[model samples]
Target chain A: SQKIEQNSEALNIQEGKTATLTCNYTNYSPAYLQWYRQDPGRGPVFLLLIRENEKEKRKERLKVTFDTTLKQSLFHITASQPADSATYLCALGHRDDKIIFGKGTRLHILP
Target chain B: DTAVSQTPKYLVTQMGNDKSIKCEQNLGHDTMYWYKQDSKKFLKIMFSYNNKELIINETVPNRFSPKSPDKAHLNLHINSLELGDSAVYFCASSQDLRAISYEQYFGPGTRLTVT
Candidate 1:
């Protein structure tokens, strides 16, 4: 079975520091990977999408890198603020349009 | 305007009850999906529809059925909801199912609690 895994423990970082989250998958090769930010009681909001051929993608202060060889993806939030504290999820989509999501990493940015 | 929306954000019902969650997308997307986020925070895909046609159905139970009347609407109907059925249901949409750029736009989830 295909499975996506992220660091289950919460990530705590200083407000001005960078927070990096990792997502790993096994038993599947996805065409693209997506990152989303989810707050409590709210749905996830799409943040970035990087194709398998793309090495890295960035949006404002956020950056995501995909390494197909390692079957892993990294999400980075630079100069993070307390407002950036939320659960971040990484998702992969296959050629057939089926998507699988990671368990997500809860990030806590302390002021 | 809300791109993707689901109705009745909170549902609290007893076991063996039947309920439905309605989803609508105004983004003119061709593909819509239903996902269940369990208590463990594991998000799993339940079903997907493209242009009102069923495209992918994951290993979901037969008690959960998805109905799509049009490209913009996909509804999930769960029969005899069990205590294990308590979870957050999310609806999402994308422009094209086959497109490599499958960045799904998600709606506010419906939290179902079966007691």
Candidate 2:
């Protein structure tokens, strides 16, 4: 069966530290891998997307690395702050508009 | 203005009842989708529509139906709702179906509770 896994159900980090999240998939060849941030009682908001051909993508303080060979993706947040705390989701998409999302990793930045 | 919106932020009903959730996007996108998020916050795509036509349907029960009146609107109708059907349903839209870089914009989501 096809599966998408975000390695950690929850992650905690001290303020100003970097928080890294992992997403791994099996049995799916997606052209693009995407990340989203969802807060409590709100729908997910698009963060960044990395193509299978691209090894990494960065936007401001956020960076995403895609390793198709290993079937995994890493999401990193630099200088993490309390305001950046939220559940982050990793999604896989093919060319035909099909998208599958993982369970998401809840991130907490303590003061 | 909100780019994507969903009606009835919260719905509470008993089992065997019928209900519907409506979604609309003003981003002039060509594709729409329906997703269900369980209590555990696991989101799964249930249906997708492009240009008012169904494109992908996951292993969803026949009791759940998706309707796309146009490219910007997709509505989900549930028949004989059960306790297992309770979840937060989200509606999303993207630029197009063929664009490899397109990212989805999701609505506020509709929380449905089946008693």
Candidate 3:
């Protein structure tokens, strides 16, 4: 069976600081990895997707790094703002399989 | 316009009853999906439809069925809902199943509560 894990504890950082979240997987070689943002009582919104061949991807203040050798992906939000507080999820997917999501890491930005 | 939408945003029903959640996507996507988020906030895929054809069905019970009238619509029908069935159901769609860059757009989600 394949399993994905993220930090279970809530990550708190001051505004304008960089916040890094980790996603680790075991027993699966995904073709692509994705990150999503989810607010309370709302569906997840796609943030970024990185292919197995790609090393890193960026969008605005968000950046995602994929290290297939380590079976991990790191999501970083630079100069974070209070409005950026939300749970971030990492997803793994192959060509023939549906995307699988991790439990997610809750990030809180303190002013 | 809302790219993806689901009807009956909030559903509260008793155990043993039956209900359905309707989903529609205006993005003209060829792949549609149904996902369930549990109390623990774990998101899991229940079903996936491509061009109105069933492509992926997870280890979901037979009590849960997904119907697609077309490429842009997918509806979920649950029979004999149990207390454990309470969760938020989300509908999503993507451009095509074979496209590697296909990114899913999600709806607001339907919160189902079985008392």
Whole-model lDDT for model 2 versus the true structure? 0.94
What's the CA error at residue B55 for candidate 3, in Å?
Answer: 0.4
The sequence of per-residue lDDT tens digits that candidate 1 reaches over residues A1-111 is: 888899665999999999999999999999999999999999999999999999999999999999999999999999999999999999998786578889899999999
lDDT of 2 by residue, B1-115 (tens): 9999999999999999999999999999998889999999989989989899888899999999999888888999999999999999999998887784698999999999999
> Worst ten-residue run, lDDT, model 2 chain A?
A92-101
User: For residues A52-78, what per-residue lDDT tens digits would candidate 2 score against the true structure?
Assistant: 899999999999999999999999999
* Candidate number achieving the greatest DockQ relative to the actual structure: 1
Candidate 1's C-alpha runs over 4 A off are none
- Looking at model 3, the pairs that clash are none
| Higher-scoring candidate on lDDT, 1 or 2 | 2
In order, the TM-score of chain B in each prediction is 0.98, 0.97, 0.97
Q: What is the interface RMSD of each candidate, in Å?
A: 1.3, 1.4, 1.4
| TM-score of model 2 (CA atoms) | 0.97
Clashing pairs for predicted structure model 1, backbone only? none
DockQ of predicted candidate 3: 0.69
Residue B21 in model 2: lDDT: 96
Per-residue lDDT of candidate 3, residues A46-91 (tens digit): 9999999999999999999999999999999999999999999999
How many clashes show up per model? 0, 0, 0
